[model samples]
Target: MQNLTPQTILKEKFGYDNFRTGQLDVIEKVLAHKHALAIMPTGGGKSITYQLPAMLFDGITLVISPLISLMKDQVDGLDAMGIDATFLNSTLSGQVQAQRMSDLRSGYYKMLYVSPERLEISSFFDFIQQLPIELVAIDEAHVMSQWGHDFRPSYLNILPLLAKIPGNPAVLGLTATATDRVRQNLQQLLGVADEDTILTGFARDNLALKIAHNVDKRQYVQEYLRENKDQSGIIYAATRKQVDELYEFLNKKGVKAGHYHAGLPERERQAMQEAFLFDEVQVMVATNAFGMGINKPNVRFVIHYSVPGNIEAYYQEIGRAGRDGLPAEAVLLYAPQDIHLQEFFVQKSEGTEEHKQNEYNKIREMNAFANTQSCLPRYLLGYFGEIVDHDCGHCSNCLDSREMVDVTTDSQRVLANVVRMNQSFGKAMVAKVLKGSQDATVKKYDYLMKLPTYGLMKDRTLKDLSSFIDYLTADGYLRIEGGEFPVLKVTEIGARVLKGQLVVEKRVNRRVIAQQKVTSAAKGLKLSESDNKLFAELKSKRLELAREAGIPPFLIFSDKTLMNMAILRPQTDEEFLAISGVGEKKFDIYHKEFADVIVKQH
Candidate 1:
């Protein structure tokens, strides 16, 4: 026990040979009784930092999780590794929770997972104080900051609860999607110094991000599902009604699908989630409610059926895919009207004026992500404060092979119109003024109709003009201000463009470019015919083992591991143990069964 280090624990327990990026650094800091905030990408092995330290420490490690399903998945995964961990949440019956608490008093578990809301209960708080708590790990730590996309009032109770704990346990905060603002707020609130922040960058290289602007979403989704029938994915819609409609549409097309949203009954939601997790359903059409606690590592894709309110939410949701370090796709189906729903949400939010305005800014940012023709991953990573100099050649934009045209003349027209209108009107009105529409609103303002910039782009349709305006705002040539009737203001860069000091270029409208067939094979491993057959057989066998063990198939073996096994064809215990995900426990339990299949195939 004294000689075991984090690396050995990682291999012995988690079955991985290396510490991914910042994992070891964070673990060393926590083990030294220091406070740290780790902002790694999703699937970047963040849990290993705290989970491994919890194994080394003599006392219990309390993990403050935000969702019940996440806790269940973590505890189950740990149990699969032959570790002692349990979760206490409202999902359990009163009698069961009481028994678990009684066991907790006896030091029966090494790690106890609970939501921050559980700490607010007087009795549970008193009970936990008596435990020998060594470290506190906060998952989804961004929710504590108002600047974060998902702010919860319940998270405010965490610091007070920790202050009352007897041992003054070291605190570790982990989040996959935190902007620089969110990170600063978290660091200040957690009393973690600037230098102690461990950010391994926010880039998922295996995800091929695509934005299909103005395409028939229903048609595109149907084609995508039909082509990738073997892969599992999640389709995120903005509303319960959309989820139901998309689910029904896919069902009508003979696709086995499930739908989940807050409107569904509790049991129905649970059943749907279980179906998706067990691989009985390959697709889950859900609203935002479905994914936070989801730990399904083999999810091959995550398609945004509609635009999200912010980049953080979008990034976090897309991060759900390709968690196993295998290639995945994140296709965002965006349309001009899709942004209206998000705008309505911002206007209807219960936050203060400042908060609401900030939300509006985020909506514009998300819109930019969808509208910009630049590298998709670079735009996403830039929003999170990591500046990657080169283009990610894998995104839709980089792969579009369309010719670039100078839009500097068109840009100056829009920027000049914003100034001509005194920058007091929204995008719709500005586009109307630029296109020289004879609408009553424009006709009523005689001065507007007589502006020098009016009818400057009369050759372009309103839709094209509107899209171009969005591109301008997204690329920082213009800014959207205020909440409800947000007006466009020209940026400093826009001024430069107007003064002929800068030139702008954009890809020709996608309608002019011939569309290529989007396929998952381009992003994932290209397997030979025999290897593909072997991989399918391995998956079937893994599913059988998972069902027998009452766990998800990924807990038995990830798709990536199975794919690697198919390619490597490990036929001996030593060879199987040399595989990437194979640990002693996994090798002891299922190595012989997997090796037998590989031997039989050869």
Candidate 2:
């Protein structure tokens, strides 16, 4: 091992002047031979934590990753930087795998990537014993937890693999999203204590989180794509059928798009992934299986075609956008019925009764997030055990200028109806009874018909009553029990509302809350006309250079770098190097090309 610090290695090899937040600390712990569990947001430079240590260690570092594509991307990136890295996965031929294993035993590589399932093979485990493994890094560590949103059974095999390695190499667990419960589970599984675990804040200020309720989703998405034609993004659907339909719609409309689902042949899926990564396609319509290991840095937006089953899934999916530190958007087009689809999935999923109930609770929280009027970022942070002292002005709730109206009367009526029915029914039945439906179920219960609170909301439409009921439930005025059949019940908070001791207010028309005009791409930038023209010119130049280099545009220079170049009008090599992301390697290659553009314009 070389006597070099992480800072020296980072500058000499990676060309980055400084470490991002929480990176140096985690790297220090690992270098000290202590275990670490890092929970960082996407694009948080997590790979460097282990990669840096691998360079400084005397022996090889084995990285157990969750996805083949992710490992390929990382290895390719490392190779581009002239670093020695390789991966062992199903994609490799048997002869090639043998050669790589031979190289591993010969100590020809510094880092090796393999799937957790590979560790379960007796022959593979024995083969690895020939090499000195100094560190074992587990990526997407949350999968080790059975309660996590993305649970993989094969991940549990890693524990035995560690025990077989000689000298007991240090361990590092890395993940992008984990709630407090999942975090604890990860710590326990990885044998790391509380102090060794570092949680970087989940706030992504550059991402504008917006939820569009009850809109014509197809029309809305079409319009959005039309406006953002030059940008790259992902549109995530809830089902494979939806993915195929949206892909067809976009293709018929002449949008540069591709679709992906598990049903597609492996070759076709690989083709689609490469097309999107190379910018041959501007939009990728996929199911949730698409983004676990995607390292595309310049994705400008992510649109959820439907609400995901849990907040953790939603957060991780949206984290794919704004990775280049440029402003991006996360738009969720939701309807009340999306929850039913997720509930059906939970019921069908094979798990214990407690696991199913946990899924149900997470689904309820997801529903609340979709309908929340509070700050979206605040709610997400609180869900992950972080307390933000103020609202994040970037989300839809903070941007909304609508007024709140008192709904105390409606709340009291809903609570009274729940009580009068003796809290034995569900939301649909309560809504039906409140709206005075003459259906057989309502008519069969004579006592429900005789209650004074029955038909109290007859003047309102069922849709409107249902909306208010959802609002009350989300606001804690009511609670729903979990099971195959959920029963509606009044909490102490609901009783207080019924007794007039508490007042409730909510946005008047929940559907119309997000009806304001969709924000223009340049709304928040506050750029002048000349700056906007310069930005366009710089972006065109970036595209031209990217084509010549045969790499993603962001790899050459991020959108944020171009934006800074446009605004600052760097006139010399030194000035260009001063811009963020313009390190020595990039400055040496394209400084003059960018400087000439700026100087000519100025």
Candidate 3:
């Protein structure tokens, strides 16, 4: 036992040859009894950092997580690896909870998972008072910061819980999303030093981010579904109504789909989630309420049916795809009207004025992400404080072959009109005025109709002109102010463009093109057509195993591992153990079954 090392444990228990970019460093910090904050991208193997340490330490590791689904998935995964792990949450009955508590007192589990809300219970606190907890891992640590997008008041209980723990366990905070401000707040709260904070980066190389600016979302989704018929994906909408409508539309199209939202009954939601996870459903149409702790590794795409309220939420939502390290697509459908729903949410939210303003700023940034012509991943990375100079070369903006047209004159017309109208009107009125509408609202402001800026872009339709105004706002030439009753105002940069000091260029025919099929980077290791067939056979065997075990298929073995088996065709026990994601226990339990299939296939 004294000879055990993290590297040795990585290969023997987790069956990986090496650590990911940030895993080893974070593990080393926590092993040295320092509080470490790990900010790696989703699917960058975060759990291994703590899971490995739990195996080395003599005492139990207490994990504080916010999502019950996440805790369940992880506990199941660990149990499948022949590790002792259990979670106590609302899902269990009082008898079952008491039984688990008794086992925990007897040191039956090496890792214990619970929510911060559970820590507030006096009975749970009393049970923990005597346990020898050597390490405490806080998942979704960003929830502790007020500035984070998903701040929860219950998360404040974590600090007090840590203080009450007996052994002064080394703390490890894990989060995939955090800005500079949120990161600073986390460091202060967790007492992690600057040197111990590990940020591998927020960019996911396998995700191709794209935005469909002002398109028929239903038509686009229909066409996309037809193109990628066999793949699993998720579609996110801004509201429950949109989720139901989109689900109905897909169902009518003869799509195998399920819908989930907070409004649904608990059992129905769980059933829908299980259907998606068990591979009975190909698509899950849901709001942001879904996908937080879901560990489905084969989700090939994520489409935002409507824009999300902030970049953090948008980025985290897309991070759900490509968790298996496979290539995935993230498409956001941007309609100018979608901004209103987000704005309504912001105005009705309870917060300090500064927090509301920050949220408004985030909305503007999310809007910009949808409309900007720059590299999509670059824009997202920059928002999270990771600056990269190179364009990702695969995003929608980079691959666009359309001609560029100078829209400086059209932009000048719009910015000049905002100034001429005293900057008091919203986007619709400005577009109406520019298109020379003779409606009562336009007529009531008699001076607005008489201005030279009126009828300036009469050749374009009101919808086209309004979309162009949104483009101007997205590109930073114009700004929208006054939250609910937003008024268009010329920004400093817009002032320069209006003064003819700067020029604007836009793609002539702006549209969302269908994403071309991209081979997973893992597949670049090479799998022949026959290899694909064998991979399918192995996947069937995995599904059978998972069903027998009553767990999600990925927990049995990820798609990436199956692909490796197909390509490698491991023929012996040692060879099978050499496969990535094949730990000693997994090799013991299922190696011969997979090996028999490989032999029969050949």
Candidate 4:
């Protein structure tokens, strides 16, 4: 362990009793000048892993990180605690960046974060060598692997460049997601000794996971938001296009909403982010880009619009919620197509077959969570090597009805239909045949010949069948050979199920009601009758207030302000603040007129 006191520094600055799980050990190792790898889950106090020790240790701790947003967020948080911290990144103007770097060199800061690409710049490297480099913290060190979720080609080149620095700073690698393979890769890449590496098994006990299967996912999401309107939350879409579309839809439905995605222009993305941070917007519909390093303590829920590629991605995404640890929700609106799509995404990742196989194992882990009869959190923790007691009584599968069925025959029938139908049928078509929907397409294809199978599954809607198919795909029993139209191919599991050799137990789908719009039922006062009442009230008040404030009415309040005041009919100063155009300055100036009119109205 590193010498000196984390307690003293933690108490003085952060006002905390102690560090959370896995923080103190990593901090100690770093201060001792030993190379270390810290693999803790998101919201697991990962920043404190390096940051606390940076304050206690000798010399400037140069922290390498991704995400300019996260850097600014952390720096701002540090600044709030009366710590002197600054970051150097693309967001800073060159002139500003140079001055900040000069300050860092001249003993102005104990910790500084620069991007990996910044490390390779020869001038930056030379200047760093001249400075007193005590420790180096690599944030999101898993990006070193192209196989890792957030691969950065630049990060792959950082290790050799760090070696060129006059003295290698004690290396501390930090990430929220890493298994044995990821941890091993991290150690080898950072050149850390095995004994120096620290692992806090991933376990988020606060989050309550729920799976809404075979339901209209969009409708389910709408209801969850409507029911939990008092609390702010995030709904993560899988694509930028989905983010934009959902944002527009929520705005039309009258939710105070904004979106964050890399696809937007930088200005728009930042504005949306700032809006959410400032609480100017109630809900932020976003892609994965939005949650990388956000530290909003009051996020009440996180809804995934789609399943993530693997458990690591799932854990990291849901970990964004309930950071204040107040029993927040992590809901997955899963269906059959979702797994196929995820598998297709995995198959498309840029890696060798060996690398693809590695991703396959990760995906299999995620699927196990989705299809498991055990507790969701328990399963999740076990995947990360943590021991969890019995069912959490919080996950969807945990609270769900457990009427397990012998679905071997059902699975085999679906598999045969896909095989018999030329192996190129779309999900809807496969589902329609199974449900005996007898849609024109199903009748056109003579799917009746395969009747005994999917035909009996008809009472269960295609949505239900689709959910089952998703599980089958995730488990590798059914392959979605991605092409123009992804065709389902039977795997060895599917073939075994056909022969009544494999038994698969699944929970029947749940019925869900779509959310109704939670908008104000009353229409606004009409502009026609509204304008006369507004004008008369404003003119009368202006005359009376003119006698009091002894100023002309126009200077006291603008016409727009008067119009809004009349429309809202605010009964008090607090209510007056609710008027659209009445900021503090205008309210103070024109208080008497508005107050008198409001008082007289009753």
- Highest lDDT: give the candidate number: 1
Residue ranges of candidate 4 with Cα displaced over 4 Å: 1-4, 339-368, 371-373, 385-389, 408-466, 472-504, 509-602
TM-scores for the candidates: 0.84, 0.83, 0.80, 0.72
Mark the 10 consecutive residues where model 4 has the least summed lDDT. Answer: 512-521
Candidate 2: pairs in clash:
none
Model 1's TM-score against the true structure: 0.84
Off by over 4 Å in 1: 509-602
For model 3, how does the per-residue alpha-carbon lDDT over 1-602 read when each residue is reduced to its tens digit?
47899999999889999999989999999888789999988778888989999998888999988878668778988998888999999999999999998898898999999999998888888888888898999998998998898998888766977877887889999998999999999999999999999999998999998888778899999999999999999999999999999999899999999999999998898889999999999999999999886888899999999999999999988998999988999999988788888988999999888788888878877887788887899988998999999999999999988758788988999999999999999889999999999999999999999999999887678988877887898778888786556789999999999888998998863211101001222436677899999999999999999999999999989998888888877666655776668889998898889989999999
Please provide, for model 2 over 396-513, each residue's C-alpha lDDT reduced to its tens digit, 9 standing for 90 to 100: 8888866587778888888989988989998888999998888998888878888898888886778878877777777677888867688888989889988999988786533232
Deviation in angstroms for 349 in model 2?
2.1
Against the true structure, candidate 2 reaches a TM-score of 0.83
Q: How many clashes show up in model 2?
A: 0
Tell how far residue 561 is off in model 3, in angstroms. 63
For each candidate, C-alpha RMSD in Å? 20.3, 19.2, 21.2, 19.0
Better of 2 and 3 by TM-score: 2
Q: How far out, in Å, is residue 3 in model 1? A: 3.0
Residue 171 miss distance in model 2 (angstroms):
0.6
State residue 309's C-alpha deviation in candidate 2, in Å.
Answer: 0.7
Point out where model 3 deviates above 4 Å. Answer: 422-425, 438-452, 510-602
> Scored by Cα lDDT, where does model 3 land?
0.88
Clashes of each: 0, 0, 0, 2
